[model samples]
Target: MKIHNFSSGPSILPKEVLQKASEAVVNFNNSGLSLIEISHRDPAFVEVLNAARSLTLELLDLKDKGYSVLFLQGGASMEFVRIATNLLNKKAGYINTGNWANNAQMEASFIGEVQEIASSKDRNYSYIPKSIHIPQDLDYVHITSNNTIYGTQYSEFPTVDVPLVCDMSSDLFSRVLDFSKFDLIYACAQKNAGTSGVNLVVIKNDILGKIEREIPNIMNYSKHIEKESMYNTPAVFSVYVSYLTLNWIKDKGGIAAMERRNRAKAHLMYSEIDRNSLFYGTAQQQDRSIMNAVFYLNEPRLTTLFDDWCIKNSIYGIKGHRTVGGYRASMYNALPIESVQHLVGVMQHFEESI
Candidate 1:
């Protein structure tokens, strides 16, 4: 049976990207050395780094716009700390949408004062907070673009006077957006971009060197940019995979094309969740994520039955987060619409049988 991967992180990649990356793993650029075994400083690897950076800026249309792209080691979680260290001078503001947003806020508190400008946690993070007020005193405002665990996302990012920072980990390349609005944007490569072990950080050059607190070279974004994202040894394999994926996105007509495909997949999945009597969505209809759709079986007793049916049909990783305790079908940029159609077929058939 063909597997339909719905795993959230280290999630789906284009089949072509996987094929190309696998070939490189065995013999990179037709050289006998495996991509993982090559020296980071070797011209071959350096070219990969340069191309990755160049392509990233090109796709975002941020070329020559005073923004620098860096593929640094450590997942988006590491950025929770590095962002505060480099940017937070006296205070920062965060919009708390879900688990990841809450974690980002908590981590920034360790560095300085953190004001939760607005939050949807009062309603179990089922909706996006609106009419957010960003104080002028804040050094920057931070937000997680999408909540994978809760299946909520910001439909439109808030307008703020302060420097805006976004963690676009889950939905980085899945849609079109005004990429220039945010002063700093960071994402883990495990989702739509590529696999694990690396994070992409795009920073505007002017935001640094303002903080009074001393930052270690390792945690400093300025230092990383200064070294051209090679301040130390980088995540070789992960970055290479990310480069391939970026190429795939560009060839597929950039983020606009991705948005159309992703919307279709989301509509397919959410339509089933709504029409089928067996299940209902968790997040508010307006706030539901196109990337990860969280829903639950109406009849809790039928949970095991549905799980068994999905497994028998080769559907995997549809289990919801423990916090939500239901089902989540993550529809990423590369998840073909057919997989969603398959899941919907299972849902409809199971509903009728039950």
Candidate 2:
């Protein structure tokens, strides 16, 4: 049976990307050496790394004057601490949207004075907060561009005079973004970029030398920028694969094409949920996530049955986050329309059978 994958991270990737990666793993670029065994310093590997970094900037339409892109080892979790240590001087403002935002805020607190300017915690993050007040004296304002687990996303970023730092792990390349608006944007590659192992950081050039805190060389963004993200050996294989994925995105017409596909996939699932009498969506209609759709059967008893039915039908990873238990269909960039149609059919079948 051809299975459909809906896992949020280490999630689905383009079929062509996977096939190309598999070939490279055995004989990279016809070098007759597996990509895993190639030296990071090798010309082949360096080309891959440089291409990945360059393509990232090109896709985001970023100019060289103000921005620097770094492919780092630690995931976005590490960036939470790094951002605070590097950017937060006296105080920082953060919008607490969901679990990941709260986690990022927690890490920032350990480094300096941090304040939750606005939060959706009261409503269990079902909706995005309308306003965030950034204090003029604060160093930077942080926002999670998309809430992966809570099924909420910011349609428009909060406007603040201060620098804006965003953790865009889940929705980094899914839509077109104004790269200039943010001082910093970091994301773990597992979601839309590639598999787990590498994280991408795009930071403003001006923020590099302004920090007062004694940040370690490894944690410092400036050091990574200076070294060209070759500070350590770097995740060579992951970076290579990420390069392939970015190339795939470019071949598919860049972010504009991706936005149309993503919007269509989300509309397909949400339309079914709205029309279906036996199922209900969990997140607020206006703030519903395009990446992850959270919904559940009207009859509580059918939850387990529905989950089992999905598994039996070779539909995978539709289970919701444990904290917000229900059904979550993570329609990532690489997930085909057919997979989503299968899921919708499953939902319709369950509704009829029940």
In order of appearance, the predictions have TM-scores of: 0.99, 0.98
lDDT of 2 by residue, 43-77 (tens): 98888888898999999999675788999988999
Estimate the lDDT of model 1.
0.92
Residue 55 shift from truth in candidate 1, angstroms: 1.0
**Candidate 2's error at 291, in angstroms?**
0.7
lDDT, residue 137, candidate 2: 90
Give the whole-model CA lDDT for all candidates, comma-separated.
0.92, 0.89
lDDT of 2 at 132: 62
Cα distance off (Å), candidate 1, residue 101: 0.4
lDDT of 1 by residue, 1-354 (tens): 799988887788899999989999999999998998989999999999999999999988899999999999878888999999998888999999999999999988998899999999999999999888778899999999999999998889999988999999999888889899989999999998889999999999999889999899999999999999999999999999999999999999999999999999999999999999989998999999999999999889999899999999999899999877999999998889999999999999998998
Candidate 2 Cα errors over 4 Å, as ranges: none
Best by lDDT: 1
